[model samples]
Target: IEKEGWSGEVSGRRKDGSPITILITASLVKDEKGEPICMMDSFVDITERKFMEDELRIKDNAIASSLNGIVIGDLEGNITYVNDAFMELWGGDDISEIVGKSAVTFAEDEDKGRSIINVLQNEGNWTGEITGIRRDGIPITVQLSAGMVYNEKKEPICMMCSLVDITKRKEAEEKLQRSHEELEIRVQDRTKELTKANIKLKKEIEDRKIAENTLLKKEKELELKSLNLEEANTALKVLLRQGEKDKTELENKVLQNIKELVLPCIEKLKIYRLDDKQQAYLDILESNLNNIISPFLQKLSSKYMDFTPTEIQVANFVREGKPTKEIAELLNISERGIEFHRNNIRMKLGLKNRKTNLRTYLLSLA
Candidate 1:
């Protein structure tokens, strides 16, 4: 039994020899002499409450020992408790000094306001990113989760918070972003450089094509001049064969002068620096001069080989530097027929693979 207005819990031996715990509360009204009293009593078994309290203590210990930072704050935004991990994160020197301090005090300057605390007080919870400063003044980035706790009267008793450090992860992400930006810049610069180089290369190719065209035109002009000289030689030859003795010496002197002086001068001009086309024309003139006329002009060698009358005429006409048209008229054939005999002469003389002008090749055999 409990005395008036006295409350206590008692553990006693039960009939089964087991221990039992009880919580008893009572109120009483006493007489004037205070010797007798009217009393009311209420009682409850408190074993369950003890078990619940022990379980809560275990949970608290578990949270304290966790690797993450855990904090408890009062509704006034004062830090009421912090676990070991939280202290370690803050330089691990003094945790007692942190007690009763405002939770927002350790936040970075950018987050110095009690926005989270106010939210928790008004809405029973808040969570977000927070930049915090450690005890040694080191900066850290963390993910924070906080919620309010309430008492039976529905008054906010405390706020519980957990912090996960994400500084390393954030740094890695920043580095990757910077690297991506740098690579893009390099790609753009390289592309610009390549574009410029391509433009220059295109210009160079155009210049080369222009130069090649100029050389080709020069070569065609030189080939025409060579054909004219070959025609004059043929005409001179026919005139020499038909002339009387007195006219022969004058005609021979004229031919000799053309060959020794005028032709040599022209040959010197042919040797001048020329483009591809000009060089091709010069090659034609040079081959005909050396291979055609030089062979037949050798008096002693003329008797060693047989000559068809057309070949003889063609040879003698070319030796005197006659044009192909004059040679065609002398032979009483069309110019095309003259060209056909010239081709036959070229094949008989095995003058294949010579890029020299055809007239020049025929004259070379004279």
Candidate 2:
């Protein structure tokens, strides 16, 4: 009585009273004469099929919402499917805009595209970096992982690919490399500067050492010269002492010769009769000669440092028993000068106010 058969999926209970899902087809069965007899129905268990469909739907949703772009392409490299992420990655508005395109259409280089195809065909998979172009023609870098899909018969059917953006990572790596190179250059420059400074310091130290050595050498030379001068002065002092001793011995010998040889001869000549004027000249000569040769004169000069030469001469004449006028005539000086000199000698001898006579003190010294 129905014009057409009805088919639908329905829920049912199994023999164990468990709930199940099935596909049902119902139609009207007729006997004859176009009269309806009974209704006939067919049931097909679809629980597994429904479950498989639900799982497939969930998987599809996961792929659509993935952060990574996904593509399914035929073995001929034609695009067959694309997820929402893939569309967004390629800057496409809809899957319809990308599904019918060649899989290699977005590859930046034709040669690289061909290579990727060849690797996928031979190895059944390819994973590497690739340059791709967006819908706006902007080039981008990606990490691509692609594999060939197979049928149940193991025949290659299509290629499944996943893409992840790697542009920022590559940029960071390049920046780090540049910074490392710059740091290396700076370290090298600093090392060179330190080396130059070290060299200069070494040179300065060497020059200072040389100056110190020169100063030490000069000091040594001056010390040696001073030592030589000291030795010369010592030798001169010894020679001067020897000369003074020789002069004293010579004066003693001259005084002895006058007393023994010359004075005795003069006394013998006085025994021969001489005129009065001659006798006076002889007395003056004897007095002068005795004064010149007297050891007492040397003793007075040495013992009395304050006595003048004239005072020493007056002392010698007074010691010889000559009066003041006679000593003046012998010395070619005035009598007053002789007396003054005698007075000075007595003062110098510490006998000015004493009762001791100058002549007696002189005789006592002799």
* Top-lDDT candidate index: 2
Candidate 1 CA-lDDT value: 0.76
TM-score for all models, in order of appearance: 0.48, 0.55
Cα lDDT of model 1 by residue, 107-140, tens digit:
9963544877778878887777788998888899
Those runs of model 1 whose alpha carbons end farther than 4 Å from true positions after fitting are 1-44, 152-154, 201-366
RMSD of each: 18.2, 28.8
Candidate topping TM-score: 2
The lDDT of each candidate is 0.76, 0.87
Query: For model 2, how does the per-residue alpha-carbon lDDT over 1-366 read when each residue is reduced to its tens digit?
Result: 298979999988899998789999999998879778889999899998988899999998988888999998888788988888878888878778888787787899978988898889999999999999998999989999999989889999899899998988988988999999999999999999999999999999999999999999999999999999998999999998999899889878987888888998888888888898788889867876776666576677668968877787788889989899988987789999998898888888999889898899998876
